[model samples]
Target: MNTDIILTCAVTGAGDTPPKNPNVPVTPRAIADDCVAAARAGASIAHVHVRDPETGAHRHDTAYFAEIVDRVRDSDTDIVLNFTAGGGGDLIPELIGTADDDRQIRAAAGSDLQTPSERHAPIGELLPEICTLDCGSLNFGNAVYLNTADWLREHAALVRDAGVKPELECFDLGHVWFARQLIDEGLIAGDPLFQLCLGIPWGAEADPATLLAMRDKLPVNAHWAAFAIGRMQMPMVAQAMIAGGHCRVGLEDNLYLSRGVKADNAELVAKAVDIIQALGGDVATPAATRETLGLRGAP
Candidate 1:
């Protein structure tokens, strides 16, 4: 079992969850405040995703990112900021019949696609200490999260050039294989950082055996973490620590403190900290986490 753990709190994800849980944090100020609160609650890193303040829909606006970055940097908090570079890859396809009765597949209403450079724009400009590089694509709920190998390779190079650590987010065994390939091709700099994303439908399941399987596939030099959504969120925290890996938790992965109790970002992080301490493991500070993962420190 790993005694020293790096706990990350994903403040807000690019999902339509603000209405479901009022504490999801839609505006830039709220998101930044939650990041600071999570840091105070013992989170070493804060994984952030911005949304349209009015609509609460996910947006790729650099201005939004700038505001969040500025707010967090201006605050008294000391935490590693991990901005989301995994946006603009949602693909919802629909088959329609034309006027001539010909059937064709076209992107549906929710499909938001972009080039590698476009998706990497925020990370490139803002220069966060770490950003996510989705290693591969998988069916994400009703839509397919599209991240081709070519795009991943290009994105990896961009992150490397910017002197930012890419959190290799592997949703399946295949993603782990390709992540290793990127390391082999010398695209990833320093030791690789992996996040085993589990429990999202049609991807990897949420269980001990599956987590172990994905964990076993990571490179020996890689610094890794794991998380599961919904009710399994807290359980996976313990499982990840016992299995010798770091872990993440927040409203991004789970909205509940209990069966029906809604939780905010800081609460989720504090709960994870409690679980880590209960398991006889201590939570690593941002400085220690940066040293462990070879991060570029705070940006």
Candidate 2:
């Protein structure tokens, strides 16, 4: 088992979950605050996704990212920042017209497709220590997360050039396969970092066997973390640590501290820390995590 592990708290996701739980951080200020709190509660890193401050909808605007980055940087907390470069890939086909044309397919109400350059703009500008590179496309719920191989290659190159580490988010085995190819093509430098995302609908199931299979396929020297959404979040924490991988927890992946308890980011992180300690494994601090992941230090 990997005794030393980096614990990341995904502060807020791009999903419409704020209505379900009031503690979910929406504004840049709230996100930055929660990230600092997570760091104080023993989270080595904070994986962030910005949303519309007013509407609470997910957005890729560089300005929103800039404010969030600045707030975190100006704080005393020493948490490593991992921004979400994984947005703008949501394709809502149900919102499209029945015109039998490519434009009809593109003309969806919730279709939030963006070019690779658009996705990389915030990360490239703000320069977080690490940003996510969602490895491949999958049937995400009712919509499709359109991260094509070509788009991933382009996104990887952009992240590499921006001097930010790419946390490869792989939801399935094929995603890992394509990530390895990116490494082989020299788009990703140094030892790769991966996030084994499990339990999303239509993706890999949140089971021990599935996680192990995905873990076994990772490149040698890769630093990987794993997380499962919903009630399986805490169980996967122990499972991931036992399987010799790092762990991730927070409001992004889960909402409950227990069956009926709604949890904020810090509470979720603290719970993970408790689990790691109970398993006789120590959580890595920000400095240690940066060194382990070969990040350019805390930013």
Candidate 3:
């Protein structure tokens, strides 16, 4: 069934994407600008992942999130902010020397490794309309994206109690199952929103059959969006819409607009907007998307 699709822009992912593409925004002002442009280009929700401006490293600072929210809210754009609470808890055991001498300090890339309370800080205070709840732990690429069940239950309840929507992020099939368990346990409130993450290594692959199977398993009355990483990114925009779901796209999932061409969050969002238009689908405004997803109004 074809419906009005909600486009999401994942502005800056917590990866080594900054150096790879100079267009990647590092400051809160730049990030908010990209988000406002994305919203103007048909995106209803902005999936934000902050980074350190000096080193271009990802950080889970509530102040950073608050500044972005303030900018977006103070602007004329009406895009819904979806701050990410999925960072932290990533533990990659050490292999320092022999098996007996494994004591690790830092793993590669950006792993804030924050506690549940710390993870919920941005969401609790900044209080975006929605924030991601990584459903289960998995190997995100070579790194282990860790979120224990106990931790998940605590985080879900916190989000529910805060009246913030949890956009369930499932890397694999098991993540989806655990997400359902949370719903059944009364941790996630109302009809949950899901983001079917695809094409990431050590998780679900980017295949039509795999995507369709995952789509089929969605809980009754749940809402979802899907995206494929790297080269398959553009193609999955069509795939997600055709599979009866919404779509997410931006520089975070992909950098190049085409071969050897660098792009920004706004360019990626415009491309997705064009594709959705050509596919005979209308994009939803923030107000429309809020009503569709049952998001509470922001003050």
Candidate 4:
């Protein structure tokens, strides 16, 4: 277990969650507020995603990102920002028609698709401390999450140019393997940072053995963290620390603090802090996290 762990609170993600909870923070201002609150509540970093205030859908516009970054930087709380470059890859085939041959090739009406450069535009313009780079494509439930090898290379080049660190988001074992390849290709800068996403349907399972297996595959100098979704969110907090990794918690990954009780980003971050301390581990501060992760300053 890591004695000095970094707690990152993913304040708002591009998930279909605004309808389920009123406190999900749809607007840029609200998201920035929650991100500050999460930092105050003991999170070293805030993984952010922008949403359309009106429809609560994910938006890849630089303006939304610019506003969120401005608000966070303007706040008193000092938290490392980790914006997402993992958008514009959702592919839903159902709307394209259920024909057998058409399912794999056509995109539905609501599909948010973009070139790698387009996806990397916000990261370039805003240049937060860090941004996410999903390593590979996988079956993200019924819809497919597409991050092909070529696209990932282009995205990595953009990230390297921006001088922003990349927190590799690896969902399955294959994704983990490909991340290592990215490092070998010298596409990633500094020591690699990984977010081992567990328990997503058709991806890696959120079990002790699975976490162990994935962690063992990480490069020697790489820094890594692990998280589980839904009911296992809190449990994985202790589990991840016990297995020698950092922790992530927020409304994006899990909605409920209990069976029927809903939680906001700050509450989830506080609970994660309590869990980390209870396990005899100390949560790293933002300054310490920056040094550890080799993060660059805000642009």
Candidate 5:
């Protein structure tokens, strides 16, 4: 079992989950505050996704990202900020009838798609120490999360040129395969960092066997972490540490400290720290994590 662990807290996701929990951190200031709290609670990194303040909908506006980044940087607390560069790819399809009785498929009300450069805008401008590069597409709930191979190659090149580390987020085995291909193509620099995302609808399942299978498929020189959503979140943390990898936990992946107990980002991070200590492992600080992953440090 690996002893030293790099823990990440995904402060807020791009989902419509604010209504379900009041502590979801919608505004830029709230999200930045949560990131600082998570760092104090022992999180090495904070994975951030901004939402529209009024509507609580996910947005790709660089202004929102800038506000959050500024707040975090202005604070005295130190933590690695990982911005989400995986937005604007939601594709919810709908069929409509034409005047001539023909049918056509088009994006539905919830569909939000953008060109690669549009998606890369925030990362390119802000240039955080790390940003997410979702490896592949999958059936995400009722809609499809689309990320084609060509788009991925272009996105990878952009991240590499910016001198930022891309956290390869693999939702399935095929994603792991494609991530390896990106590494082989030399688009990914230094040691590759992977985040094995599990238990999200039609993606990889949350279980020890599934995690092990995906872990085995990773390149030997890769640095990786794993997380599972909902109730399996804490269980997977222990499993990841035991399997010789890092762990991630936050309101983005889970909202409850326990059954029927609501949790904020820092609480989830504290719980994960307790789990790491219980398993006889220590949590890695942001400085240590930067060294371990070869990050470019704070920007």
Candidate 6:
């Protein structure tokens, strides 16, 4: 165990969990407020994704993201701003039965299926301290999380050029392999930071053995965090800390703190902190995380 860990709160994600839990913050202000609360509760970093304030649909609007970042930066928080660069590659192929017809299947939805430049556009504009670069794609629920090798390489270079540190999000062991390839290609600078997503359907399962298995294959000298969806959230915090990786938690990944108990971002971070302390571990502060990740000035 590393004893020292960086704790992150993914405030609200782009997933379709809005209807299930009314507590998930969708507006920029709500998300920003949650980030501040999480920081005060012990989060060194806040992973952000903007949503359509009205419908609660996920959005990739730079302006909306900018508002959240600005609000958090101006408030009583010094949490590391980690913008989402994982949009634009969303390709929900239209189910227009036959390929011969220029007929459209389902129109492309979600921002992750975009081209490399489109994906990199917001990061260049917002220039947050850090951003996420999903190394590859997998089936996220019913949607095919989309990312190709070429696309990864292209966007990695752009993220590198933007002078923003990227926390590589790896949904599986192969994604970690691709993160290593990004390092080899010299597109990702600094000591690599990785987020191991667990218990996502069709991806890595949320279990001690599976977390350990995927973690064992991490690149040497890499800074990694592990997360499990729903009930596994806080449990994985201990698993990650004991295994020498950092931990991330929030409502985006889970809704309940316990049976019938709904949680906010602050509650999630608080739970992670308690677990870390119980394990005799220290949670990384924003300054400590910035130093450890070697984040450069944003573009």
Runs off by more than 4 Å, candidate 1: 98-101
- Stretches of model 3 off by over 4 angstroms after superposition: 96-111
TM-score, cand. 6: 0.93
Clashing pairs in 1: none
Model 4 local distance difference test score: 0.92
Q: Cα deviation of 130 in candidate 1 (Å)? A: 0.4
The TM-score that candidate 2 achieves is 0.96
Model 4, 1-299: lDDT tens digits are: 78799999998799889889988999999999999999999999999999999999999989998998889889878999899999999988753447877654578777888999999999998888999999999898888898899999999989998899999999999999999998999999899999999999879999999999999999999899999999999999999999889999999999998899999999999999999999999999999998898887422
Worst 10 residues of 2 by lDDT: 98-107
Which 10-residue span in candidate 1 carries the lowest summed lDDT? 290-299
Better by lDDT, candidate 4 or 1: 1
lDDT of each: 0.94, 0.92, 0.88, 0.92, 0.94, 0.87
lDDT for each residue of candidate 1 in 1-299, tens digit (9 for 90 to 100): 99899999999999889999999999999999999999999999999999999999999899999999889989978999999999999999999996656988899998999999999999999999999999999999889999999999999999999999999999999999999999999999998999999999989999999999999989889899999999999999999999999999999999999998999999999999999999999999999988888877523
How many collisions per candidate? 0, 0, 0, 0, 0, 15
Q: Tens digits of per-residue lDDT for model 2 on 1-299?
A: 87898999999999999999999999999999999999999999999998999999998888888887788879978899899999989997763555557434453688798999999999887888999999999998989999988999999999999889999999999999999999999999899999999999999999999999999999988988899999999999999999999999999989999999999999999999999999999999999888887888533
Writing each residue's lDDT as its tens digit, candidate 5 over 94-172 gives 9999765698889999899987888899999999999999999999999999999999999999999999999999999
Per-candidate TM-score against the hidden true structure: 0.97, 0.96, 0.95, 0.96, 0.97, 0.93
Worst ten-residue run, lDDT, model 3?
Answer: 103-112
Tell me how far the alpha carbon of residue 279 in candidate 2 is from the true structure, in angstroms, after superposition: 0.5
Give every collision pair in model 2: none
